[model samples]
Each structure stands twice: as C-alpha cells, then as structure tokens.
Target chain A: MKGKLNLNFLFALALLATAAVLPLFLQRTSGGKYNMIVLTYAMIWAVAASSLNLVLGYTGQACLAHGAFVGIGAYSIAIMVERVGINYWLALPLTCLLTAFVGFLIGLPSFRTRGPYFAIVTLCFNVIVYATFENWTWLSGGYAGQPITLPAALSGRLARYYFVLAFLVITLLVVRQIVKSIVGASFLSILSNEGLSEAVGISAFRYKLLSFTVSCFFAGLAGALFATASGRVDSSITSYLHSFYVLIYVLIGGVATLAGPVLGAVGLYFLLDRIKGLGEFRYVGFGVLLILIIVFFPRGLVGGLNQLRDWARERRSARSPGEEVAG
Target chain B: MSFFVNQVIIGIQLGSQYMMMALGLTLIFGILDISHFAHGHIYMVGAYLLYIFSVLLGINYWLALPLCMAALALAGVLVERLVYRPLRGTPSINTFIAAIGLLLAIETLVRGIKKDAVRVPVPVDRSVSVLGMSLEVQRIIVILGALVILLLLQWFIQRTRLGIAIEAMAQDREGASLVGINVNRISALTFAIASALAGVAAVLMAPLGSITPEMGNLLILKAFVIVVIGGLGSIKGAIAGGYILGIIEALGVAYISSTYKDVFAFALLIIILAVKPTGLFGERTAS
Candidate 1:
C-alpha cells in the first residue's frame, strides 16, 4: 500500500509538471491573453480554495470568514509595498505571518463552538474585517482601497501569470505535504471523530488551531498575490459574498481530495466567465448548482470520480475466475 | 438631558427591530440546529412585497404590512418543504450551504427584477419633536412596530399549542418526537413564523430607509451577532442580545466612528464566543 501510494504521488507530480509546461507552450502558440488571464485567476482561486479545504474539507469546520483573511494578507502586502516601500517579495512572508496570527486569534474562540455557531463567529469576523477596512481609511484606504504596484521583474500579464502559477504550485505542494504528515492524519481523525481523536491522545484543540492557522497563512499568501495581481485591494474582495464564492468553489470541486479545489476553482471561474451576461441571475444559477451538487453529489466532482474508480475495482474483483479483463 | 433621552429612545427603537429579526433566527437555530442564511434575504423580499403593495398596487401602507406577512408565511412554508425537509438528517454544513444557496438565489432573483437599484421608499414626515429633542417619526413607528410584533410573537410562542411543540422540539428533538410531537410540522411552523416576522420588519423598515437588494446582508450579520450573543437557543437571550447590540451600536456610532458601527457587535460576538461560547444564556453541551 505504501509503495502504491508513493507511485501514485510520483505519477501525480509528473502529470502536474507536464500540465504546467503545456500551458507555457500553449501561451506561445495560441497568444490567448483572455484565456491566460482566466487561467491565472483560476489558479489563484485554486490556491485559496485548497487552503480552505485544509480546514473545511479536512477538519470539517466550516468557515465563512476566509475572504477576510485573504483581505488581511492582500492589504498587508499592499500597504507594506505601496506605503512602507518594502519589497513585494519580502512583504509576502510578513503578510502570511500576520494573517496566521490573526487566524490563531480567530480560531481560539471558534474552538468552543461547533457547526453553525462556529460558522456564525467566522461570519462575524468577516464583517468586522470589512467594517474595519472601510472605516480605517488611513490604514486600508477606505472603500476605494489602495492601488498596488507590481515589482519591476514581474510587470507583464504573462510574467504575472507564471509568478502566480509558481506560487500556486508551491502552496499545493505544502498542502500535500501537510496532508501526508502525522498532523494531517490527526486532522482527518479530528474530522472523523473529534471526541475519539481527543480520547486517543490527539489534542483536537491544538490540531484544530494548527490546521486553521496554516490554512489562514496560505489563504493570506494567496490574498497578497491577488492584491498584486489585480493591482488594487478593496474591501469588496473581502466581502462575505466573496467568502461564499470561495466556499462554493471548495464545495463544488470536492472537499475531501487534494485536487478537488483545483478542479472546482478552475471550473467555476470559467463557468462564471462564460455566463457573465446573466448578471445578477448568475448567482441564481450558481446557487441552484450548489444545492443540486450538495443534495446529489455531496462527495463533489472529484470525489465522485474516485468512487467510480473504486467501484470499477470492485467489479473487476468480483468477476468470474479466468474471465479476460480488458483495459 | 433631552439629548440623552433622545439617544435612549432611538437605541430602544433600534433594539426593538433587532429583537424582531433575531427572534425568528434564534427560534430556527434552536429548533433546527441549522443557520438559516436566507432569513435576511427573506426579510428583504418581505420589504419588497410591501413595496409592491403600497407603491405599485396603491394600497395603504398599514394594510400592505399584513399582506406582506401573509405572503412571507407562504414563502416560508415553500422553503421549508422544498429545502429544509430534504436535508433533515444531513450534516449541518449541508443545511448551511443550502441556506446560502437559497439566499443567493433569492437575492439574485430580486436583483434581476429590480435591476439591483430598488430601494425601499423612505416614509414621509421625517422629524417630529418629542419634548426638546427632535426624532424621525418613521423611526418611532419602526420602534413601536417592532415592539408590538415581538410582544405578539412572545405570546404566541408561550401560549399556543404549536408554539409549545416548537419549544419542546427545540429543547430536545428526539424527546419531543417521542412524545407525539410532529417535528416536521413544527419545523415548518417555525420557518413560517420566522419568515412572517421578517416580513413585518421589512414593512416597518421600508418607510424608515431605502431598500436595496444587498441591504439585508448587513442586517443578517447583525442579527446573527444578536442571536449568538444572546445564547443560541434562548429567546430571552435573543432579546437581551438585540438590545445590548443596539445600545452599543448607537453609542458606538455616537462616540466612535459611524463607519465602525457594525464592528461593535462583531467584536462583541468574537469576545463572547471566545470567553463563553454558549453565549449569555446558552448552556454548554458536548456534541
């Protein structure tokens, strides 16, 4: 089983590497600016959604304040680079640290509350962040938000895309590592049985906080990247609505697996872009999609695929002896 | 002295509205163990229903108010039947997402119809002086309306058979069911009452301020805070939480910055969650 898992990991890594390079090669031939931009945004969302999956998907803790943490990261980087004249590269780590600290603070209180209560607390946190961002004009530039200037090395859309892609890859790898680690096992255990996990000497409180803080750190990192990518940081990006959007991405993609959020973010971004003309009706579509997906495909798109594969294996195993198997 | 008195009255008025909105949310949370995110949007819809009756149909605002409530009650039953009933034994998150989806769907539908520019008309006759301080007549009406509705709701919950069943179910769903209570019926009734209360609030609120498609977003957040701080399943907690939040908000806006007015309640929620997760009146239980 361990060897098979390692082989699967290697296969996934190769597939990702090939896909990453294929995009660059396609960019050269197709010259699809719009496509590239869409792809870039999708990748950014993928990072954010996956980070959320660390908490919501793996830990079974539903958070509605994710966009606020993203805002914190975005605003922090923008403020540092724009006003304090700090280098963007240097500011990224600082932003992540600060966001992680804030996440720890938020998580502490949320630990006591379960399910809906926890979600409401996170919702309140998001509102507070938004209110502060809009009111603390001196710090966040109020509703207008602060304009961001990209570093000299990363000026063009193509370059920015690659930069974002690189960040997404790194964040994915980090998440993958965490999920494969003992801490990840603990996280899964907590999600499965919080009481049993506690009884089994795994401190659910400590691990829950750890998962939350780590998730927030990456979410903040994505936010910082997003701020630079968009060239502006606004409270609108941190709105409760945006948080819901991210949640939608996580839910629709498949929360249990690592690649679920990636598929969801990329899929939903393009889906929305395609139906942009629907205007407000777009949300109606999105909402309906969420309900249908939850009611019927709770395992999500990726999880459903995994189930199919498992079912195929079972069928093959149950086949009569000496039956020829065709691949 | 008049200034202080005026602020107190305004605070109470705001508190009353908060209580009216929070009461339904509290009851739903207590009974269903689910957070109804669409409740605010329903309130928004109710206000728009009033807008249609009074503005378009040319009905009297007083008559339109009850009409709006009746419509919302119908909508509530539909939502409960279609949405809540399907996910009875599902995880709470499933219900939460469904509620969010419903909120998005409703808000989007309203926005599509109104082009997202619809605002509730402000009632005529802005300022009326009581003693030395002047206040908005609409504001006073809103306060009175909220208080009357809350009193009626409280009476219904305490005195009525359906209300008693709801209370019992809220206390212990399995136990209530074992005692011949129709859990599904009570759940539907709870949704109906909550939606109707929200409708009444919308009507009262419409005259006081302009209604926008997204207006309910902030109101919902504030209501959640009130419900949480009041102690999840406790009606008295909801009332106390609402008044406390309203007073704090008014005072915070007066002394601090108006832009940060919403932050006070949220900050309070976080503090309460951290220090005492069960809220002021909620009992702590291990799940």
Candidate 2:
C-alpha cells in the first residue's frame, strides 16, 4: 500500500511538473495571453478553495468568512504597495501573518461551538468584515476599494500567470503535506468524532484552531495574489458572495481529495466563461450545478472518479486467473 | 428620558420585523434540522407579492396583505413538497446548497421579471405621538401587526393540534413519527407558517425600505444573527434576540458612528458566540 502510494505521488508530481512546463512551451510557440490569464485566475481560486477545504472538509468546520480574509489580505497588500510604498514581496508575508492572526482570533471563540452554530458565527463575521471594509473609508478606501498597481516587472499577463502558478504550487504542496501529517490525522479524527477524538487524547480545540488558522493563512495568501492579479481592489471583492463562490468551487470539485479544488476551479471557470448566451445566468447555472453535485456526488467529482476506478479494478481482479496481485 | 423612550420604541418596532423573519427560520431549523437559506428570499417574494396585489391588481393594501400571505403560504407548501422533500436524508450541506440555489433562482427570476430595479411603494399616512416623540403611523401599524401575529402564533402553537405536532416533530423527528405525528404534514405546515409570516414582514418592511432582489441578503444575515443569538430553535429566543439586536443597533448608531450600525450586530454575535455558544436562551445539544 505504501509503495503504491509513493508511486502514485511521484506520478502525480511528474504530471504536474510536465503540465507546468507545457504552459511555458505553449507561450513560447503560440503566445496565448488569454489562456494564460484564465489559468492564473484558476490558480488563485484553486488556492482559495484548497484553504477552505482544510476547514470544511478536513475539520468539518464551515467557515463563511473566507472572502473576508481574502479581502484583508488583498487590502493589506494593496495598502502596503500603494500607500506605504513597501516592496510587493515584503508585503505578502505580512498579509499572510495578519490574516492568520485574525483567523485565530475568530476561530478561538467559535471553534467551541457545534456545526451550524459555528457556521452562523462565521457568516456574521463575514458580514461584519464586509461592512467594515465598506464603511471604513479612511482605511479601506470605503466602497471604492484602494487602487493598486502591479510592479512594472510583473505587469504582463504571462508574468502574473507564473507568479500565481508558483504560489498555487507552493500552497498546494503545503496543504498536501499538512493533510498527510499527524496533525492532519488529528483533524480528521476531530472531524469524524470530536468527542471520540477527545477521549483518545486528541485535543479537539487545538487541532481545530490549527486547521482554521492554516486555512485562513492560505486564503489570505490567495487574496494577496488575487489583488496583484487584478491590479485593482474593491470592497465588493470581499463580499459574502465571493466566499460562497469559493465554497462552491471546493465542494463542486471534490472536498476530500487534494486535486478536487483545482479541477473544480478550472472546470467552473471554463463553464462560466464558455457558456454562450448565458451572461447573467452564470450564477443560476452555478447554483444548480452546486445543488446537483452535492446531492448526487457527495464525495465530489474526485470521489466519484475513485469509485469508478475501484469498480474497474474489482472487475479485472475477478476476471484474471493467475495474476499475482500484491495485497 | 423621552429620547430613550423613543429609541426603545424604534428598537421594538425594528425588533418586531427581525422577530417575524427569525421566527420562521428558527422553527424550520428546529423542525426540519435544515438551515433554510431561502427564507429571506421568501420574504423578498412576499414583498413582490404585495406589490403585485396592491399596485398591479389594484387591491387595497390591507386586503392585499393577507392575500399575499396566503399565496406565499401555498408557495412555501409547494416548495417543501417538491424541493425539500425529495432531498430528505441527504447531508446538511446538500440542503444548504439547495437553499442557496433556490435563493439564487428566486432572486434571478424576480430580477428577470422586474429588471432588477423594482421598488415597492409605501402607502401610509399619519403619525402618532408617544411621550412627546413622534412616530410614523406605518411603524405603529407594523409593530402592532407583528405583535398580533406573534401572539396568534403563540396561541396556535400552544393550543392547536397541528402546532403541537410541529412542536413534537421539532423536538424529535423520529419520536414524533413513532407517536403518530405526520412528519411530512407538520413540516409542510411549518413551511407554510414560516413563509406566511415572512410575507407579512415583507409587506410591512417594504414601506420603510426599498425591495430589491438582493435585499434578502442583508435581511437573511440579520435573521441568522437573531436566530443564533436567540437560540437555534427557540421562538422566544428569536423574539428576545431580535429586540436585543435592534436596540443595540439603535443605540450603537446614536452613540457611536452611524455607519457602523451593521458592525454592532456582528460584534455582538461574535461576543455572544464566544461567550455563550448555545446563545442566550438556547439549550446545548450534542450533534
């Protein structure tokens, strides 16, 4: 089992490396600016969705304040670059740390609560954050959102694409490692049965806080990247609807697996952009798609695919006579 | 003293509206164990229904109120039967997504019909003076109407058979079924009652605020706060929480920055959640 898992891991890594290089090769040959732009947005969303999955899927905590964290990161980064004249690279870490601190503060109190109750608390937090961003004109530039300018060095779509792509790769690997670590096991145990986890010496409070903080950090990082990518900032970007969009992306792709969010982000983005004559109906279409996916494919797209693979393997094993299969 | 009294009155009036909306949400959460995200949209639908009856159909506002309520009640029953019933036994996330979809669809449909700019007109005259503070007649009417409805609901839930069945189901679904309570019928009725109340709230609230497709977003957030602060499934809690929120907002706006009124409710929510997770009046239950 461990050997097969290692092989699968290496294969997945090789595939990702190859895919990452393919874009550069394509850019060299075709110079597809639009494709690169879309891919960058997909990477940003993938980061956001992966962060949400840490709490929602792994810890069984539904946080609706994700977009608020994104806003915090974006606004923070925007202010650092635009107002304080800080280097973009220097501002990014500060944004992540500040967002993580805010997440810890929010999670500390609410983590003690049960499921839907915690969700409501987070919902309230989102609203408050949005309201603050809108009303606090002095800090957040009010409803207009502070204007941000990307560095001239990374102004082009392709450069922004590579920046976001690299960020996504780093965050994804960090999340993947966390999910495989002992801390990840604790999160799963806490999610599965909080009381049982407590009985088994797993401090539910500690792990919940850890996962929540880590999730918010990534969301904040994504927000910073998103701000840089858009080269514009607005309070509207931090609205509850944005948080809902991220949640939809995570759930639609497959919450349990690492690759689910990336697939979800790419698929939904393309679906929204490619669907013809359905300009304003994008939300309606997305909503219906979300409902269908949740009701039928509870484990999500990746889970569904895994079930198919399992079925095929079983059939092959049943048909084969003397094929030695390692247990 | 007079200023304080005026603030109290204003708070109570606003609280009544919040109570009306939160009551339905809390009941549905309690009875069905599902968070109905579309409740606010249903309230929006109620306002639209009032506009249709009062303006388009040329009916009087008073006559149109109950008519709209009845219609929305029926719509709620249909939604419960068709949309919610089919997805029974699914995880809470499924229902949550469904509710979001339903809300989006309803809002989109309303926008499609009204071109995203429909506003319900306020049709009321006269002002009443209480303790030297003048208040609008519409505000008085809305508060009185809310109180009457709440009292009637209280009576029905306490004294009526269907209400008792709903209570039983809310307390324990499987146990209610074991005791011969028709779960489906009660759930449907709860939806009807909740929807009808939301309709009433819409009619009254539309006069004070503009009605739009996205109006429900803020209203639903407030209702959720009220329900959480009051107690997830407690009617009395909803009422108390609503009044508390309204009063806090009123005072917070008067004393603090007016722009930060919305933040007060959320700040209170965070404080309350941190200190008392079960809410002020809610009983803690293991999931």
Candidate 3:
C-alpha cells in the first residue's frame, strides 16, 4: 500500500514538473507565445476555480460571486499601482487580505439562506460588485478599464508566466492540504448531509464561513496575478456572466475533485480559443454540451473516466472465471 | 411632486412588464419547483420573433402578438418535455445548471443571428401630455395592454377549470395527481402559460427600446428580484414585488443616478434574503 501511494505521489510530482516547465517549452515552438498566454490564463483560472471549488464542490454551496472576488483583486491591484502609488508586490498581499475580509462579510449575509436563495444572493453580490466597478467612475475608471503597471522585472510574458505558476502551485498545495485535513472531512460531511452534520454538533456556519473566506483569499490572489499578466482590469471580470463561466469550468471539469477545476479551466479556455472564429455561435455549442454533461455526467470528466476504468476492470474480471472469484 | 408622479407613472409602466415576467416565474416555481433560469431567454425569443414577424414578414402587430405568444407557448412545452422532465427526479441544482446551459444556447443562437440590436417599431410614435407630464402614447398602450392581459389572467385563474387545476397542482402535486389531475399534462400547461406570459412582456417591452440578445440578463435579474420580493411561488407576491421594484428603480434613476439603477434590485434582494428568506408573501416552508 505504501509503495502504491509512493507511485501515485511520484506520478503527480512528474505531472506538476511538466506543467511548471510547459510555458518555457511552448515559447520555443511556432505560435508558442500565444499558447503560453492562453496557458497562463488557464492556470490563473484554475486557481480561481479551485478556490470556487472550496465553496461549491466541497461545501455544496452555490457561490455565484467568485468572479466578483476575482474582480475585487484585479481592481485593487489596478487602483493601488496606478492611483495609490503602492508597489505592485506590496499591494497584492494587502489586497488579498482585504478581499478575504470582504468575502467574510458578504458570506455572513449570503450564506444565511439556503440553496437557490443563496445562489441568488451571491449572484446579486456579483452584480453589485460589477455595478460598483462600472458606476464608480472615480475608483474603477468606469467603462474605460483600468490598466495595471507591472514592474519592469516581471513585465515579460515568460516572467509573468512563471510568476502566475508560482502562485498556482501555492494555491493548489493549500487546497490539497485543506481537502486532506479535518476541515475537508467536515466540509464533505456538510455536503453529504447538512442537517445530520448540524445534529452532530458541527457548526455549519463557521466551517462554511471559513471556506468562503479562504476561497476568496486565493481567488483574490489569482485576480492579482491576472492583473499582473494582462496589465489591465475591467468591470467585465466582475460581471455575473464571468461568474457563470467559472462555475461552468468547475462543473465541466468535475466537481469535488482538486484536479477537476484545473482540467476544466485549461480545457475550456483552449477549446473556446480554438473556436474564436465561430464568434456568436461559439457558446451555443458549449451550452448544449453543458446541458448534456449535467444530465449524463454529473460527476464530470474525471468521474466519468474513473467509472469507465471500473467498468473495464469489471468486464475483464467477468471474462475470466478464476479472476472473477478471486476479485 | 409632479416629477414624483411622473416617476411613479413610469414605474407603473415598467412594473407592468416586470409583473408579466414574474407571473410566469412564480407559477413555474409553484408547480415544478424549478426557477427556470432560461425563462429570460424565452422572453428574448419572443422579442426576436416579434421582430421577424412584424418587421421581416410584414405581419400586423395585432396578428404578430398572438402568434408570438403561441409559438413561445409551444417552445416552453418543448423545453419542459425535452430538457427539464428527464432530470425531474434528480437534484434541483442539476435542473438549474441545465437551465443555465439552455440560456447560454438560446442567447448564443440569437446573438449569432444578429449581433446588432433589433428595434421593433410601434404604430403609435405620438406622445400625450398627462397632468403636465409628457408620456409616450405607446407607453400608455403597453401599460394598458399589459394590465388588461393581467386582469384576464387573474380571471382565468379564478374562473376557469384549467387554471384551477394548475393552481391545485401548484399547491399539492401528489394530492392533485391522486385526484386524477394528469400531472404531466398540467406540468406542460404551467410551463406554457408561464412562457406565454414572458412572451407578452417581451412584445410589450420590445417597442419601448432597442432589443438585444444581452437584454435577457438584466430582465431576468429584475424578474428574479421581483419573485423574491413578492415571495417565491405567490402570484400576488410577484405582482406586488414587480410594482415595488419598478417604482423604486424609476425613483432611484430619476433622483439618485441612472447608472446605478440595476443595483437597487440586487441590493434589495440581498436585504430581503438576509432579513426574510420567505419574502413578504412567501410561505415559511415552501422554498
């Protein structure tokens, strides 16, 4: 068993190492620069989606304000660097802390309701955030979009790629640690049976609040990285449609699994990018695909693959009587 | 004071449209227990269909209106049969996600067909002075037209057998089924009625301004706010909530700021959800 665990760990490490070095490899190939940019975007979105997973997947809460948190992070960096004269690096940590605090406050009222009601409140929060970004001309620069000035040292695409990659690693590690810890078990318990968990003396509100705050902190980090790489922030990032896009990533990739969000973000980003020429009809296919996925593969791609493997193994065992009895 | 009255009048006009949309939403929520996220897209379809029938096909507006409603009713039934009915026994969230997918699909279809805004020309472009305030004749027609439809809808619900059956199903699905209500048929009927209501809203609002694919997002959000305020699944609540939201929005835009008009509904929703999850007219246990 220990050997098997070691093998799994080794494989995961190998995958991570490949992912870490992928952008450098891409830069050498034809049209690699654009691919690198898209890859960086995927990684950044992966971080956000994973943070969203903390609420939607683990806690079984439908938090539609995730993009708003991302927006908050991006706008903070934009305002601080461009208007407040704070150093980009110095402003990031403060911005994340502020976002987490705001998330905690928002979660207080947002999580008070249950199910669809909660979904709407969070969605409303998303709208409010976007409205603030759009209407507050003095603060967010309104519809013109605010630009972030990355320091000369990290302005290069490759450098920014590595920069975002570092943050992605930290986010994934933190998420993995949380999911593997006692809090994660509580989260799953809450998700599996909320009323029973409460009966068993689990303070549902506290754990959920903790999850929301932590999720927002990381999402804010991802937002800062987004601003650093893109060098601009706009109200569109905070729009509820963006929130829906992030939710779709988590849903399509697989919910409740750590790798699902990453797979979904990267997969869908590239898929959409590849079909840019389709323009208006592009999302129509995705919409149908989303409905099909929800209906047939509620567990998402990873879950579907796991099921296929199990089916294959079962079939093999059935084909051999001796193996079947042993199994 | 006259400005306030004007805002109130404008609010009533906007509220009438909102009421139409929310009526369908509340009815769906009452019976199916699903929010039908794609309902807004159905409204968008109604607008586009109006544009096609009245503008492209050169059909009369009076003729186009009924045809649009009937088409939307058929579309609603198809959506219920094809998309929603299969996932009926699953978790409600699955249906919600499916609805979102449907919204995306329909919105993309419309956007792909016409990226630019499509305007529906009203027969009456003239304005009339009422109590020293100028109001568009088309606006008054839309308001009176929506009100008449709403009253007819109320009468139908109160006086007609099919409407009573729908209300019975909404109140208790299993019990109504035990009484031989034909649950499947009623489900389709409820969806049809709701979609037709949304169609009415779309047609009325289409002539008021430029119609765009993206309008569904704002319209749906407002309808949601109204549904929440009036209490989910309560027709009366939806109507009251619609007027409240419309007036507040009109006043907010007129007095406070036009740019932040959308913020009022969402902010109110948050407040309502936090303070009273059941809404003013909602039952404690239903949602």
User: Which candidate leads in TM-score?
Assistant: 3
What ranking of all candidate models by lDDT puts the best one first? 3, 1, 2
Runs in model 1 deviating more than 4 A are A1-18, A22-31, A142-144, A320-327, B116-127, B285-287
**lDDT, residue A265, model 2:** 80
Q: In model 3, what are the clashing residue pairs, if there are any?
A: none
Please give the CA lDDT of all the candidate structures. 0.84, 0.83, 0.87
Q: What is the lDDT of candidate 1?
A: 0.84
Clashes of 2: 0
Ten contiguous residues minimizing lDDT sum, candidate 1 chain B: B115-124
Interface Cα RMSD for all candidates? 1.8, 2.4, 1.7
- DockQ by candidate, in order: 0.66, 0.54, 0.67
Model 1: colliding residue pairs: B119-B211, B120-B210, B120-B211
Candidate 3: C-alpha lDDT? 0.87
Return the TM-score for each candidate structure: 0.94, 0.93, 0.95
- Candidate 2 Cα errors over 4 Å, as ranges: A1-31, A318-327, B285-287
Clash pairs (backbone) in predicted model 2: none
- At residue B41, what lDDT does model 1 achieve? 91
